[model samples]
Target: MRVRTDSHGGHGWERETGGPPGRAPSAARAWARAAHPVPVLVVTGLTVCLAVSMGHSPGSAALVALAVFAGQLSVGWLNDLVDAARDARAGRLAKPVAQGRLAPASVAGMVLGSALLATGLTALCGRRAALAHLLALVSAWVYDLGVKATAWSVLPYLVSFGLLPGVVTFALPGSPAPPPWLVVSGALLGCAAHFVNTLPDLADDARVGVRGLPHRLGAAGSRVAAALALLGSALALAGAARLGGALGLLALAAAALTTVAGLLWLGSGRGGVRLAFPTVLLVAALEMGLLLTAGLPSGAAG
Candidate 1:
């Protein structure tokens, strides 16, 4: 069936009942699409970085890694759930059920299952970590429900991202509570994420009344906000390094490079399609690198 064209940049595919000529989206394909593996992969990478940076025990590290996967799954599935109508209207091939490859009911089931898994696993981490995980889920839901459309779209990111490192560290046996600087730095990175996440869909979002901080700022303003976030994060990390040592410096450098690269991408002549995916990829990388920095030996980092 035909539907309105996507105002944002995403692939266009015709919805057919018979399925793509010879191709099929089986249980594996459905799972992949439902899981939205990219974000999960990025989060996993971040967990590793954190483990190395902090010299976490293997068991603790494993739990944190699992938390990342569970967290991303919750985020990804919820995104699809909230956007299902929009995807239907836009005839979005990028979405699982929207392309007629999977059923909406099935996707909903996946969301429920994943969220339950996340909650159970998080509880094992500790009361504090579990609370953080719950907070992240709540923040995401708030964003989906219309907080994101308000001035508060940024709040969800701040709360959610800030809690991440703490949750990981909390999982460790006998480790001190997460440092204030790490959480603060994470909040700063969240601000950047708010901008970067909204880049590709600004147009479609506007078209469908999904205006958030990015829409309010417009493209130029959004880009500026993104750059400033990077700068601010870098400065914070640099200061952190002064107090904490070499790993801080390396983290700051990584944050700087990440911000610069994002700004460069935004400024490029390339259309949103080409730019958005890469930007997302870079943002994920930056987060992972920052987390990993804590593990690098002074000499190795230098």
Candidate 2:
């Protein structure tokens, strides 16, 4: 029996004899994998935490969580669907669509469904909040559609993440804007995440002709860029806390330690390279924690 493999890595029936291919993964399982659950959960959980910290009622926080979760799911599914061919070519079997376990059409349908759900949910929050949330979702979709392969790839991350705080703050009674420091810190962290996230996939990306900013920077350069961005985010958060105070000092010290640890790991050769992404995530979490602790200042909230 001669087997044929499609571009999506699906084994086609034999050319000589009509026979069934191997069983595909169940739709539910494939859809779950295609949704990129970890990042979706992390982003949604973080948004909910931000809403709660900003004094949102439990119901408001739950709404924020649901909207953000649906939005993230759409983003994740769209990304997989858009990159299905590239991922398959690069042997990225971890992606359900690339492995042929999930159909691109199914992913596209989920993307539309989740995006509409997110939009409707955000609208219930208020006009300003809905606008901010919708813009963020659009920015992420732009990245997935084409910007991820361009030099301006990080632009979407900056725009999306920077607007994230507003998605919560604007849902407040007055629809107040988030503090400038919070927006700046979020943008910096998002930039760092973009660089760090691209590190592991640099090779595969290059193979598929994706030459984003991180890909052009190369591995070591991307690591340095990520470190610098993290430091900048830390400083932004510290400023928001008013650097002369104890809280500010604590934030600075923690930031310094995290940056140093990440740098050391980067310099530790191949064995420690695996720690890079986790280290960046740790710094991001630290920045978010500091932002939560600082809360919304009276003047800033107004």
The per-residue C-alpha lDDT of model 1 at residue 156 equals 86
TM-score of each: 0.79, 0.86
Q: Can you tell me which runs of candidate 1 are displaced by over 4 Å?
A: 1-27, 242-258, 261-268, 271-273, 276-302
Model 2 TM-score (2 dp): 0.86
Model 2 lDDT per residue over 1-302, tens place: 12226564544212112333333334456677788887787788679767866788889889988999999999999998888888878887677777665555667888999999999999999999999999999999999999999999999999998999899888888899988887888888788878877877888899999999998887888878777887887777777644245764485658656665665454336544566666766766765565566565433564
Clash pairs, candidate 2, are: none
TM-score of 1: 0.79
- Judged by whole-model lDDT over C-alpha atoms, candidate 2 comes out at 0.78
Predicted structure 1: lDDT:
0.66
- lDDT per model, in order? 0.66, 0.78
